[model samples]
Target: MSISTDHTQLQRQLYLLGYSHALPSDGVVLVSTLLKDLQASLDRVKELEASTVRLEREERTTRLGHDKAKGELHALRTENNSLRAEVLGHSREADRLRRESRADQYRLSKVADDLRMANLQLKAESAELSRSLGDCQRRCEARLSELDPRGKIPRMTVNRPFDVSRLQTHKTQVQPAIVDLVDLSSRRISALEHEIEHLEDKLSTSGVELKAAQMEVKERDLELMRMNSEYERMNPAQDVGDSQVPRLTDQVDYLHERAEALEKEAKDQREQFAKEKEDLHRRWVAAENDRVAAGDASWWRQAV
Candidate 1:
């Protein structure tokens, strides 16, 4: 039974026995001490519970932040890979362009060599044609003088022989064609060079960007490692604290159980004491009744 109920029952019993207003000071002190101990235990349990809850909250928040940072790190890694692939592709394109430009330059060089040989051949052919024209011109003039005798036919002023105008015309036409070919080749070479320069610029810029991206990724990786290290540093202490909580709780529970057992033992002892007191009181009353009976018997005998 509860202390208050037990006290009330004890008081009623005492009132029935003509001791209505007295209480045992030792019993009151013992009950008060038990109550104080129980209150202290309850307070300790509340504090432990609050501490456990706060630790759990902090652990959950830390885990969430760590997970979020990991997710962002994953995204950065994916982007870094994509940029790396892009740089690789650009690098390959630049290589291909360089190969094409070299091939074009080789072809242009061969064409220029062929044009030089053709110009030499044209010069040699022109020299042979001029000699043949001079011979033909002398023969024609001798034959015309023999046929005309005196001075009937007029002498030619310019004796270029086999139509110099036609040869000049051929030379003019062929020179312009060769010059146009060279000009076209030069323009093509210039255009290719310009295109190569542009591609090189783009490639260089891509290289720079790729380097910057790599640097950023490296920095992020460093930061991530730092964060991980920091988390590692911090988590062990929290884990140690968390691990200790159960042990502390077990200790608390053991104390509470010990207290409860002690309280039960005290209650049982109190009940046993009350039972013994009642038995003693009954024995004393029985002895007094016997004594009164004996006295009445003697008086009766005397009266008789």
Candidate 2:
């Protein structure tokens, strides 16, 4: 019989307890054909057993491949999550740096403004000092001109005739002190001017530094924006999802559950196939035993 017919017969025998119902119409067949058919059935069983083993191996390989893919995907997701965290951290750091830079710039600008106000105050004080010194010099010159007459021993004008000698002695003593006072005022004015100039130079330097700092801050802001743009492009999904470990862990858990469900389904299929194979094997063994017993009974009857 053909392999297909043998397989059909075996299936029928497994379900119906015997293959007599499916016997061919050739009544002249030898008893050897029955033995040969039994041998073919056994061979088919062996082939089925080999095929089962190959299928089990393939199932195991497929399971292993599934597990490997899951692990790789999990690792990739973990790395992506970590990269997102790193990018967020960098963004926070950039924000902090920007705030600090702004604060420093504000303080520097305030200092520069204060310095400018102080410079204006110094200029006003210097002008006031100059005016006061000029007034003192004029007062001293007027006093000396009233007290002494140049190239004359003493002046006895009609209005100061009685006070000429007293005036000469006082003028000689006070003139020197007035000259000292005028010299001190001049020196003070010079010192004040120098201090104002120094402050102006310092203010100029501070302005230059502030401008450089502002430029640096602008560059940093541009760089930060570029980094943010790139990060957004690289991981737009990360931005859409909540940036938390819990959420990522939940997603991982969901993936693991899906993988486990697939694995469970595969395992269940293997178990069901094994159960069916075992049932078929048992039926084949019982059928073989029944055939052998019938053959023995027939031989014993013939011997008698």
What do the candidate models score in CA lDDT, each in turn? 0.61, 0.53
Worst 10 residues of 2 by lDDT: 156-165
Clashes by residue pair, model 1:
none
Query: Candidate 2's residue-wise lDDT over 1-304, tens digit each?
Result: 6755665655555456544554443422433366568889999999999999999999898777656654554454555445444433443344344434444444454445445544554454445444444555677667777687573333322432122123343322223343244345556556656655655555555556555555654554455445434444444475634434444574576557556655765675576568657856875786689679768977996796
By lDDT, who's the top model here?
A: 1
TM-score per candidate = 0.48, 0.40
Clashes of 2: 0
Q: Per-residue CA lDDT of candidate 1, range 1-304, in tens?
A: 5766767766665577576676674476564566568779999999999999999999899889867765664565455445545544544454455445555555555556555555565564556567555656677788888898886454445544443335553433334454355457667667767776776676677667667766765675566556545544555556545534543554465456556655765675576568657856875786689679768977996796
Q: Candidate 2: where are CA atoms >4 Å away?
A: 1-26, 30-42, 151-304
Q: In candidate 2, which residue pairs get closer than 3 Å at backbone N, Cα or C atoms, i.e. clash?
A: none
Off by over 4 Å in 1: 1-38, 138-304
TM-score of 2: 0.40
